[model samples]
Target: MKVALVGNQNSGKTTLFNCLTGMNAKIGNWPGVTIERKTGTIKGTNYEIVDLPGIYSLSPYSTEEEIAREYIFKEKPDVIINIVDATAIERSLYLTTQLLELDTKVIVALNMADILEKKGIKIDEKNLEEELGTKVCKISALRETGINKLISEIKKGDKLKRKPIYDVEIEYLISTIQGILHSSDSKIRHSRFLSVKLIEEDERFDKYQTQEIKHMTGLLAKKYDTDFEEIIATQRYNFIEKVREKTVIYKPVKDDLSDKLDKIFLNKWIAFPIFVVIMFLVYYLSVGIIGSNTVDMVSNIMDSFSEWVGNTLQSIGTSEVINSLVVDGIIAGVGAVLGFVPQLIILFLCIALLETTGYMSRIALLLDRVFRKIGLSGKSLIPFIVGSGCSVPGIMGTRIIENLDEREMTTMLTPFIPCSAKLPIIALFSGYFFKENSGLVSASLYFFAIAIIIISAYILSKLVFKNTSNTYISELPEYKLPNIKYIAKEVWDKVIAFIKRAGSVILICSIVIWFLLSFSFNFEYGVDIQDSMLASIGKSISWVFYPILGENNWGATVSAIQGLVAKEQVVSSMAVISGFSEEVGEGSQIFGNNTIFSSFTAASAYAFMIFNLFSAPCFGAIGAMKRELGSNKKLLKVVCFQTFLAWCLATVTYQIGSRIENGTLHLADILVIIAILLIIYLIVKNSINKKKDKCINCPYSDSCK
Candidate 1:
C-alpha cells in the first residue's frame, strides 16, 4: 500500500511519518525544510509512505506547493495521511479541504493532541469526522501515542463521500466549468477539481482550457467583488471556521511554560545576545577542549591502525610504490579528515537539538529586524543556519523566500558560513596557529562569516536590489525538550555521511593527488614531488595567492583549489603532500619541515584559512547553486563574486596584519589600503545612486509635481 503524508509546515507531519516508517529523516521546526519528497517503508508492514514537502495549500504558489500538488494529482497514492496540528486545526484544515476534493481516501491524523489537552482544548473527533466525511484519529506523533489506531484507520480504507462546500454562486460556476472541461479533450480525471481550478484561474491548468474559461473567471471575479481565487479561499475558510466551531472546545488557562520561557529567550533586548552566547557555547563545546580531546583520541586510534597496516605491508615485502600508495595516499589522506569526526558529530548534535527544541525558529524571528536593514527577510536565516551543516541544502532552502533577489542574495552568501565539510580546515588551522584558544579562533571565523554576509547583503542591496522590501512571516513552534534519541540519530547520520564522503570522494581525490604528485609529466614513477606534474600545475596559479600567503607557495594554492572538489580535501591534500600519516597535532612541525609550510607565518596561515572559508564552495554546493540560480550567467557571477571577496579579504588580512605585527609596510600594504578605499568608495557611490533612484520614484519629486 502506498501512503502519501501531507500537512502544513510545522504540523508534525514528518514526525508522524517517522513514527510510522521508523525513518530517521531530519526534521526542522521551520517551513521549507523538506523541499523535496522522502520515502520510507513501514517496519512491520508492506506499506510504503512517501513524505511530501510541507505546504500550506494546493494553490501551487511556491515550488514546494507545486511539487505536493503535482504528486497527489499524478501519483494517486492508495491512502493520503493528512497530518493536522490539533492546536491549529482551523489553519491546517484549509489544506485538508483541498485534499478532500481529490479522488482519494484521506485519514486525518490529528497530531499534537497532547499539546491540545495541555492547553485545555478538547476536539470532538466524531464531529470532525462527520463534518469532513473522513475518519479522524487523534495521535501524538512525538510521544508515539495512538499510532496503532491511526495505522488501523489507514488499513480500513474507508472512502470519504466528499461533499462540496462552496457557496451557491461559486458552486454553479464550478459546475459550468466542469461541463465545459468534460466536453473538451482534457485528460483531467478529477473534473470537479479541474472545474474549481478553472474558476479560481489557477495557472497550472490554463493550458488545458481556453479563453472561454478565462472569460468566465473574469466574470466570476466581477460578480464576487474580489478575485476569483480570493472567493474560493473565503469559502474554504468559512467552511473551516464552521468545522472548528462545531468540534473544538477551548478552556481558559494561565500562562504556559513556552510563554514564560519566551519572555526571556524572545525578549528583544536579550534575545540576540542569548542567541550569540548559545552559538558560542555550542562551538566551544564542539571545537574546544572537549571536542579536541575526543578528536585526539580518535586520531591516536587511526594512527595506530595506519602504522599496523604499514608495518604489515613492509614485512610482506610489498613494493615501495604500493606501500606508499596505501600508507601515504589512502591512509594519511582519508585519516586526516576522519580524525575530525568527533568534532563534526558534536556540532551536528548541538544543531539538531536546537532544531528539535524549536529554538531555531525563534532565532529567525529575533534576527529578522537585523536582516531587514540589509534588505533580506527573516526567511533567509533558515538557509544560513542550514548552511552551517551543509551549503547544498542551505542553498536549496532559499526556495521559501518569495523575493527572487533576496533568494539569490541568500544563495550567494550562504557558503560564507563554514559548513561541516570545512570543519577540518578550521580545526587544523586553529590548532596550529592559535592552539591555546582554538575554539575562540573557530568561533570568531563564524562571526566573521556573519559580518561578511551582512556587509555583502548591504552592498548587494544598494547595487543590485535597490529598494527591495523586507517582508517575512514564520510560525513559532512551542518549545519542548529535545528528543535525545532524535539528536543521537541525527548526529550519527551526519558522522556516517562524513565518513562515507571521506571514503569515496576524498579517498579517490587523495589517490589522484598522490599519483599526480608522485609522477612526472612523462608518467615516470617515483619522481621527486617538487619536480612532478602536480607541482608544475600548482605553481602556474600559485601567484594568485602570493599576496595572502606572503609567498608563491604552490602547496597552499593547490590545497585551496582542491577545496572546490570537497572542502575536507584541503586538509587531506596537505596531509598527503606533507607525508604526515600519524596524528597531525598542533604545531607538529610537519609542514614546517616540509617546504610547503616553511614560508607561512601565523598571519599567513589565518589568511589561508579565511580564503578557503569564504571562497566558492564545493562542487556539490556549486551544482545546487546552478539549479537554484537557474542560469549559468548568474552562477558565474556568484562564483566570481565569491572568489573576489575571498581574495580581497585574505589579501587585506595578510598584508595589513603582517605590517602590524612586524612594524613595517611594503608595496603590497599600500595596494591593500588602496583596495579597501576603493571598496568603500563603491559602497558609498552605490548608496547614493540608490537614494537618487528612490527620490526619483517618490511622489514628492519636483518633476512629478
Candidate 2:
C-alpha cells in the first residue's frame, strides 16, 4: 500500500509523516518548499509513504508544486493524508477542499489538535468527517498522541467521496466538465479533479481545453461577469464557512503571550533593532563566551589524543613519514574541524530555540515590509534562514518564491549568509585575532554579509532585472512554548551532520593536503615545506591574495581556495600547513609573529573571512544552484557575480582598513571610491527610470483574493 502526505506550508504534514514512518523530516516554523519528495516505510508495515512538498494549493506556481500535483494524477496513491493545522482549521481546510476532488481517499489528520484544547477551542470531528465525507483524525504529531488511531484510520480506508458542497448550478457544471474529460480519455484518473481545474480555468489544464468546454466556460463567465477562478474559490469558501459553523466552537480566554510580545517585537520602529540585538546575542553566546571555553576544553583533549597517537607510532617503531601522516595529516586536519563541534552545538541550539518559539515565522512577516522595498520577496527570507545550516537546501528553498526574477535573484544572494560549514573558519580567525571580542567580531561579520547582500540586491533589481513583481502571503504561526525534545533533536542532528562532514570531506582533504605538502614535485618524501609542489601551486595563484591580504601569503591563499571543496576544509588546510611548518609553535603561539600565521593582520583576517563567506559557495551548493537555475549559463553568471563581488569587497575592506591603521592613502582608495560611486549612480538611474512603474505598496493588493 502507498500513501501520499500533503499539506499547506507549516501545517505539520512533514511532522505527521515522520510520526507514521518513523523518519526525520525537517520541521520549522518557516515556509520552505520541499523540492523533492521523501519516502519511508510506515513502521511495522509494508506501506510506503511519500512526503510531498508543503504547498498552499493545487494551482502550480513552481516545479515542486507541479510535480506534486502530477504525482497525485499519475501515481494515484491509494490514500492521501492531508495534515491540517488544527489551531487554524478554517484556513487549513482550503487545500483540504481541493484534495477532496482527487481519485484517492483522503484522511484529514488534524495535527497539533492537542494544542487546540489548551487554547479553549473544541472541534467536532464527527461533524467535520460528515461534512467533508472522509475520515478525520485528531493527532498531535509532535507529542505522538492519537497517532495509533490515525494509523488505524489509514488502515480502514474510507470509500466515501467528496460530498456536494457547491450550489446546484456549479455542481451541474462540474459534472458536465467531468463527462467531457471522461469522454476524451476513459483511462483518466483525476476526471473530477480535471473537471474542477477546467471550471477554475487553471492554466495547468490549458492543453485540455476543447470547444465544448470553452463554450460552457464562456457561458458561465458571461453569466457570472467575474473571474471563473474566483467563482470556484468563492464556492469553496462558502462551503468552508458552512462547515466551520457546524464544527467549531471558540471559548473566551485571557490575553495571549503572542499579542503581548508582538507589540514590542513587531513594532515598526524598534522590531528591526530588537532582531539585530537578538542575533548579536545569539552569535555572542554561540561563538564568544560559551563556545570559546567549550572549544578550549575540547581542543585540549584533541591535542592530547594527537600526542598519544604520535608517541604510540614512534614507540612502535613506525616510519617517521607514517607517524607524521597519522599525527599531522589525518588527526590534525580532521581534528581541527571537530574542535569546533562545541560551538556548532551552541549555535544550532540558539536557532532551534527561535524556531520552536515560532519567532522565526514572525521574522518573515517583519522582513516583508523591508524586503519589498529592496526588490526582494518575503519568501526570500525563508531560504536565508534555511541556508544558515547549509547553502544547498537554502538554495533549494528558493523554489517557494514564485516570482522568477525574485527566485533567481534570491538564489544569487543566498550564499552571502554564512552557513554552518563556515563556522570553523569564523571561530578560527575571530578567536585568534580578536580574542575576547571573538563573538562580537563573528556577529558583526554576519550582519555585514547581510548588509552587503541588501546593497547587491538593490543594485541588481534596479539595473538588471526590471518589471519584477512579488506576490506573497505567508501565515504567522501562533507563538508557543519551546518544545525541548524537538529543539534537542534539531541541535543533535545538525551537530552529528557536522561531525560526519569532518570525518568525510575534511578527512579526505587532509590526506590529500598532507600528501601535496609532504612530497616535492618529483614525489620525493619528506621535503622542505617551501620546496614542495603545493608551494609552487600556491605561489601561482597567490598573487590574487595580494590585494585582499596586502601580501602574497601563499598559505592563506591555499586555505581560502580549499574552502570551495568544503568550508570546514579551510580550517583543516590551515591546521595541516601549520602542523608541517617548522616555525609554528604550540597552542596560541601557532598564530604568533614568528609562526605560519604571521602574515595575517586583524584587518586582513576579517577581509579574508568576508571573502570566503561571500565567494562562490562550496561545489555542492554550486551544483544545487545549477539545478535551481536550470542551466550552466545562469549558474556561470551567478558564480562570476559572486566571485567578483567577493574580490571587490575583500579588496576594499583590506585597503581601507589597512590605510586606517597605517595612516596612509594610495591608488586603491581611489578605486574603491569609484566602485561605490558607480553603485550609487546605478540606483539613481534605476529610480528615475522606474518612477512610473506599479507601486507594490498599494493597500488593495489583496482585495481580489
Candidate 3:
C-alpha cells in the first residue's frame, strides 16, 4: 500500500515519515527545506510512504503548493496521511477539507499533541474527529510517541469518508460545476475536486473550462455578490472556525517558553549580536585551538602510518618509483584531506546541536529583521542556512520563494556562504598563518562572506532589479533538549560522505596530480616541479589569478583550478605538489617547516582564500544551479558573474592589503586594476549605446534628441 504524508510547512510531516520509515529525511524548523518529495518503506511493512511538499492549501499560489496539488491529482495513493500540527489545527484543517473531496482515505495525524497542555491548548481528539468526519491519531514524531497506534489505525483502515463541508448553496454550485465537467469530459479523475478548482478558476484546469462552466461561474459570482475566489475561501475558513470552536479549548495562562525566549533571541538591539557570538563560538570550537589539537593528533597518526609503510617497502627492496607513488602520491594526497575529518566532525556536531535546539529558527527570525534593511526577506535566509551544510540543497531550497527575481538573487547569493567543502581551504590558510588564533580567522571569513553577500544583494537590487517587500512568517518550533542520537547520526553521515569523496574523486585527482608533478613535458622522471607538465599547464593560465597570488605561483594556481572537482582537492593537490621537487624544498605537510607555500605572505594567502571562497562552487553545485535556473543562458551568465566578481574582489583586496601591510606593490596589481576599470567602462559604454538605440526608435525621439 502506498501512503502520502501531507501537511503544512513545519507540521512534522517529514518528521513523522522519519519515524515510520526510520530515515533521516532532512528536517528544518523553517519553510523551503523540503520542497521535493521523499519516499521510504515503512519499517516491517509493505507500505511505501511518500512525504509530499508542505502547502497551506490546495490553491497553487506557490511552487510548493503546485507540486503538492499536482502530485495528489496524478499519483492517487491508497491512503492520504495528513500530518496536522495540533498546535495550529484550525489553520491546518483548511487543507484537510480540500483533501476530503478526493476519494482517497485520509487519516489526520495530529502531531505535537504531547506538548499541547504546556502551551495552554487543549485538543479534544474525539470531538475533532467527529467535526471533520475523519479519524484522528495523536502522535509526536520527534518523541516517537503514539506512532505504533497510528500505524495500527492505518493498517486497520480506521477512517471515515468525508461529508460535504460548505453551505447548501455552495454545495449546489459545486455539484452544478461537477455535472458540467462530467458532460464535457468523460475521463475526469476527481470531478468533485475539479469542479471546485473550476469555480476558483485555477489556471491548471484552464483547458477544461468549457463555455457552460464559465457561464455557471459568472452566474454564481452574480448570485454571491462577492468575488468568487474570496467567497469560496471565506466559507472554508468559516467552517473551520466552527470546528475549532467545538474541538479546541484555550486555558488562560502566561506566554509559553518559546514565546518568552523569543523576546531575548528576537530583541531589536541584542539579537544579531547574540547570533554573531553563537556563530563565533561554534567556529572557534570547531576550527581554533581545540579543533587544531584534534586535527594534529589525527595528522600524527597518519604520518606515522605512512612512515611505517615507507620503511617496510624500503626493507623489502621495493622500486623507488613504487615507494614514492604509495607514500607521496596516494597517502600524501588523501591523508591531507582526511586529517581535517576531526574538524568537520566538530563543525557538524555544533551545527546539529544548534539545529536541534531550535536556535537556527531563531537565527532566521533575527536575521529577517536585518535582511529587510538590505532588501531581502527572511525567506532568503533559509537557503543560506542550508548552504552552510552544502550548496546543492541550499540552491534547491530557493524554489519556495514565489518571486522569480528574488529566487534568482537567492540562487546567486546562497553559495557565498562557506560550505562544508570549503572547510579544508579555511583550515589550510588559517592554520598555517593564524596558528592558534585560527578560530578567529575562520569565523572572520564567515562574517566576511556575509558582508560580501549583503553588498552584492544591495548592488543587484539598486542596479539590476526592483526589490519587492515580502514578509516572512514562520511557525517557530518549541525549543527542546538536544537529541544525542540524532546529532550523532547527522555527524556520522557527513563524515562518511567526506571520506567517500576522499577515497574516490580526491583519490583519483591526487594520482593525476602526482603524475603531473612527477614528469616534465619530455617525460623525464624526477624532474623539478617548475619544469614539470603541471607547471607548464598552470603557467599558461595562471595569469588569471596573478593579482591574487602574485606571479610565478603555478602551484597555487593549479590547486585553485583543481578545486573545481572538490574543494578538498585544493589541499590534496598542494599536498602532492609540496612533496616533490628539491627547488621548492621538501615538506612533511603543506605548512610544515620547509613548506612549498613559504613564499606566500599573510595578505596574498588571505586574498587567495577570499577568491576561492567566493568563486563558483564545485561542478555538483553548478549542475544544481543549472537545474534550478532551467536555462543554460542563465547558468552561464551566473557562473561568469560569480567568477568575475570573485576576481575583482580578490584583486582589490590584494592591491590594498599588500600596499598597506607590506609597503610594497607588484606590477601585476597595477595591471589588474586597469583591466577591471576598463571592463567597467566598457559595460557602462554598452549601456549608453543601448539607451541611445532605444531613443532612436522612440516616437518622441525628435523632441528628445
Model 2 scores worst on lDDT over the 10 consecutive residues at 692-701
Write model 2 residue lDDT over 473-559, tens digit each, in one string: 557777878777778898998898889888898899999999999999999998988888788899899999899999888888899
- Write one digit per residue (lDDT tens) for candidate 3, span 21-66: 9898877566555788889999989999999889988776667778
The TM-score of predicted model 2 comes to 0.93
| Per-model TM against the reference | 0.89, 0.93, 0.92
Q: How displaced is residue 79 in candidate 3, in Å? A: 1.0
Off by over 4 Å in 2: 157-161, 665-705
- Across 1-705, the per-residue lDDT of candidate 1 in tens digits comes to 889999998888788878888887778666777888888987689898988888888876567777887788888898999999898888899989988877678989999988887888999999999999998999999989999988887789576667678988778877888888778855657788777887777777777667887787677677668777777888899999998999999998787888999999999789888988988887887788765677557767877898899999999999989998998899988998998887888889888888778888888888898898898888898899888999998999998887878888999999999999998888888776777688888888899999999999998997787655678665788888887887788788778889999999999999998898888999998877778778899999999999999988888889899999999999999888877322343435335544466567778878888999999999999999999999999999999999999999999899777887798978886888799999998888988878888889898877753
Distance from true location, Cα of 685 in model 1, Å: 2.5
Error of 1 at 683 (Å): 7.8
RMSD, every candidate, angstroms = 4.3, 4.6, 3.9
Model 2 clash count equals: 0
Task: Supply the TM-score for candidate 1.
Answer: 0.89
